[model samples]
Target: MLEHWSSSEVDPSIRLDYWRDVAHNWVDVQPLSPGDALEASWSLLRGENCFFGTKRSTAYEMRTSPRHVPPGEDMVVISLLEAGEMRLNAAPGEHQHATAGMLGLYAPRQEACYHWGEGARQTYVALPRSVVLAALGREPGNLLLTPQRCALAPALAAQLAHLGLLARQPGRVSAVEYAGLLDATRALALLTLRNLGRQGEAADLPDLEENLHAGRHAAALRFMEQHAHRQGLDAAVIARGAGCSRTRLYEAFAAQGQTVMGALRELRLQRARAFVEHSPRLHVGALSWRCGFADPSDFSKLFRARFGLSPTEWHRRVWMEPALRRGA
Candidate 1:
C-alpha cells in the first residue's frame, strides 16, 4: 500500500479492490481527505468482512473541521501510527502528537478529517456496525474512545514488518499462507481490542498472568545473575530492579509457590557445590565466599541443612564421579 501516487501534487488513490463477500451492504467509500491533503492510499485486508488497512498522510498543515462523517452508515475505524503526530478530537480530551501507539473508534456515520503534522504513517482497522455494537454494547454515538494499552502493539509492529516482507517476496504466497495472514490480522485485532479494554470481561486466568511473571521474573533473574557475586544482593534490590514492591515481589515468587530465600540459598549453594565438585583442588572456604556467603561456617551449615552433608563432604562425594552422580 506504500505505492507513491505521483512525484507532483497528485493525491494517492484509495484502492479497495477486495469486495466479494463483505457480509454487508455497500461499504460507503469515504475519501477522508482535505483540499490541502496530498497523497493518500490505504492497503486493505478483509477477515470475515472486517477490514484492516494502512494509510499514509502526506500532509503538512492544520485544518479546522476538515472532514466529517454523517450519522447513518455503521462502521468503526481505528488508527495506529508508526510515527509522526496528529490531533484527534474525542471524549476525555484531544490527543496530540502521539507516536508509536493506537487511537480508534466506531465510525458513527459522520465526516472526519485529522490535522496531521507533515507525512505520517498510520494503520487502520474497520469493523462492521454489528461487530462494534456487539463489542461496545452501545450505539455508534455512545461508543467513544477508551483508554487501551495493547501489549500487542509491539507484536503488531512485528506483524506489519512480516506483511511488508511477504509483499516484497518474489512470488505469490500459497493460498494457505494467505489464509494464515488473514487469520493473523483478525487475531491482532481481537488482541488489540482486548488490550484496549474493549473486550468482554475475562475469567482472569493465572496463566494469562504469565507475561507479568515473565517480565518481572526475567528482570529479577538477570539482576540476580549479574550481581550474584555481591554479598549484599537481596530481595529489596531485586524488587526495585523488577519495578515491584518488596511484598509484591515476594508474592510473585510465592505465586510460583517457591520460597524466595530458600530458592536463593539453594541457587548460591548449588553454584558453590558445583565449583567445588568440578575443581578437585578448589578451596571450600574460598568457594563459599565467592558465592556471596560472608562466612564459610554459615555456608557449610546451610549446605548441610539443605543436602544432609557439609559442602566439603558433598564435593568429595560428587568429585568421585560415581556413575550415579555423573549428571552433576
Candidate 2:
C-alpha cells in the first residue's frame, strides 16, 4: 500500500511542524528553507524486500546522525533525480553534483547531506544494506553515476521508474508479481555496477560455492574493464583483484576462446573507438594515451586491425559523414 502526505493538506499554522514530523518518520531531514508557503509532498510504498518512494519539495538538507536515524533501519538509499538539481556532501570537503538522469547511492550509517534546489523532485529505492552488498559483492561507497556514462544505467533507471509506478498501484499487483519485480530490480542494479566496472571487490559468499568459478571469471572481466585506463594493468593484477589463481583465471578466459591480456586489449581498443566517435576534437596521440597505450604507433596498428582504419581516419569518417549528409 502507498501512503502519502502533503503539507498543503495541513492547517497553515502547523504546516511546518507537521511536515517535520512526517519527514522524521522516514529519515532524518531538516528544512533549510522556511516560510508559511512551504509546499511539499511525499508518497511511499513498503515491499517485502524494499521501499519505493517519490518526494517533491522545496530546498532541504539531510542530517543523518545516531540520534536522528530511525532505530533498526539499515538501508542503502538509491535516489534518482527527476527534476532540479541536488548537491551531495558525502564527506567534509567532498561534494558531488547530481542532476536529471543521474543516480546516487547512499550507504547505511554514512554521514551525508543532500541539498536540493528549488522545486526538486526525486524518486528513491531503499533496500537493506545486506541485500545490496550481496548483489554487488562489496560496499560501493557513496557513488553518483550518470546513466549516459554506462550502457546498462538507462535500463536500470527505467526499471526503477516502472517499479515506482507499480508501487503506486498496489491493488493491481499480486504478491508473486511483486517478488518478481524485486528480483528484477536487484539484478538490474548489479548489472549496472558491473557495466560501470565498479564490481569485483572481494566479498564473502556463504552459499555461492557452486558458482564460485563463474563468479571469479566474471569478476576478473569487470576488474579489467574498470582498470583498463592504467598502463600497468595485466593478467596478474586481474587475477589478484578477482581473488583467483593466475592459472585458473587464464582457464576461465580460455573457456570463452580468449586470453586475459587479449581481453584487456580489446576492452581498451573499444574504449578508444568510443572516445574517437564521441569526441571529435581529441587528437589521435592523446586518445591513444588516454586509452592506456604507451606508444601511439602500436595504438594505430591495433586500431587498423580491429576497425579496418587508423584512429584518425575513423574519427574523420564518423564526424565528417554526418555533416556531409546534412549539407546535401
- Which candidate leads the pack in TM-score? 2
lDDT (Cα, 0-100) at 94 in candidate 2: 25
Model 1 poorest 10 in a row by lDDT? 15-24
Q: What is the C-alpha RMSD of each candidate to the true structure, in Å?
A: 22.0, 16.2
Q: What count of clashes does model 1 give?
A: 10
Candidate 1 Cα misplacement greater than 4 A, ranges: 1-37, 60-73, 90-93, 101-113, 136-154, 164-176, 198-328
In order, candidate lDDTs are 0.53, 0.71
TM-score of 1: 0.40
lDDT tens digits, residues 1-328, model 2? Answer: 5677888798877766677676545446655422225678887766777877777787776755445556667777777888888867622122366777777777746666767767788877777777777765667567765554456767777887777767656578876776677767766776776665552333222245426656766788778777877888878888999899998888766654456787788778878988987896858788888888988999999998866678888777778866887899
Q: Of the candidates shown, which would achieve the greatest lDDT relative to the real structure?
A: 2
On residues 95-124, what C-alpha lDDT tens digit does candidate 1 reach at each position? 233555535443535433344544676665
Instruction: State the lDDT at 129 in candidate 2.
Output: 76
